[model samples]
Target: MEKLEERFERLERLAEYFIEEMADFKKWVVRFLSEYKREVDRQIREYKEETNKRIEEYRRENNKRWGELANKLGTIVEDIIYPAFRPVIRKYFGCEPEKTFMRLEYINREKGIYEEFDAVAVCQDKAFLLEAKSTPREKHIEEFKEKAKRFLQYFSEFGDKKLILIMASLSFKEDFVKQLSKTNIYAMAYREWEYMDILNFEEVKGA
Candidate 1:
């Protein structure tokens, strides 16, 4: 009932319609994929930014805690260690200090001299100069020796008395105590980790 050439023409029209529909479908799929990729990239960028902000805040908090701890340790020399000086001096030196001074500063503008002493104790015939450190090291020992050399220049009244230098800390290594014994300076620290006493008093007295 249908002619062969007419049937062929009808099939060609259907083929053309399918081709146009396929092209539109492909364009829509590409657009959807591109939009999805952009959304994913934006989410990833926001996540990274939030993570970095949290990390920076945590770091700042950690630093604040460490700073507070350091301040507490610094005050130990002034508050805890210096207060124990009187008893230690009386026990070791066999006499109580007549005059006690803490955090004393002496400056002679005319002579261009400036000095600061952590603690000083004066007796009838002896003057004790105390230097306290939270953590004592070899450099601190050397620095205290230098300070002792200039003590009489600042306090001329103490020049007539026998000057005794004391280096004090919360604790000292056994080897460091031995090293201190060889020096003229007396090392004061906790004995048996309980009470404060001079570690090298006898050795220093004999020297």
Candidate 2:
């Protein structure tokens, strides 16, 4: 009887040692996982911030370049291109096409009003609002609103005058353009130079 009781107590001590070792191993595993998870989270945050910074820098550089190009293109078009077309216009219609230049702001009295239209050619009190894009896209409507609308009402106002809107772009979707045409407005693609087909053009002279 005495020997059996001693063996039982020894077995209990061994079992207790195993339970304590297992508890310590579990704690070590939990600590290791917590540290790894924190490091991974930090790396992900850093990656996101770096990506955003790079994207912003790219936009800044590209926008500067585009502005420069647009200015150059505008000068070239006004100088050489328009002159070439003028002779054609004179031969066909006995008149020249007038290109109006406008910015995104208006000086109304002492106050300033923000506007979207780039320019208009007014012939005989008819207003032809012009929106010029070097290369348009399918998602151009959203982009146009941002650049064109001056954080105010996004409206092109010929203002009770003969209202005509002409859009000049290289890549305009036919279906989307069809919808634009339905709005009692005119959209001009590269194919048709008569974008808005303004009655106010010099073609209607002596009418």
- Tens digits of per-residue lDDT for model 1, 26-144: 99899999999999999999999999999999899989988987898777767777788999888888989999998889888998977888899999999999888877888888888
Model 1: runs farther than 4 Å from truth? 1-58
- Winning candidate number (TM-score): 1
TM-score of each: 0.70, 0.44
Deviating ranges (above 4 Å) for candidate 2: 69-73, 79-81, 94-189, 192-207
Measure candidate 2: CA RMSD: 10.7
How would you encode candidate 2's per-residue C-alpha lDDT over 70-165 as one tens digit per residue?
A: 888666434433333334334433443454445444545545643545554544445444455565554655555454334233334444445444
| Candidate 1's TM-score | 0.70
Alpha carbon deviation, residue 194, candidate 1 (Å): 2.5
Please give the range of 10 consecutive residues that has the lowest summed lDDT in model 1.
73-82
Model 2 TM-score, 2 decimals: 0.44
| Model 2 per-residue lDDT at 200 | 25
How well does model 2 score by local distance difference test? 0.53
After aligning candidate 2 to the native by TM-score, how far in Å is the CA of 78 from where it should be?
A: 1.9
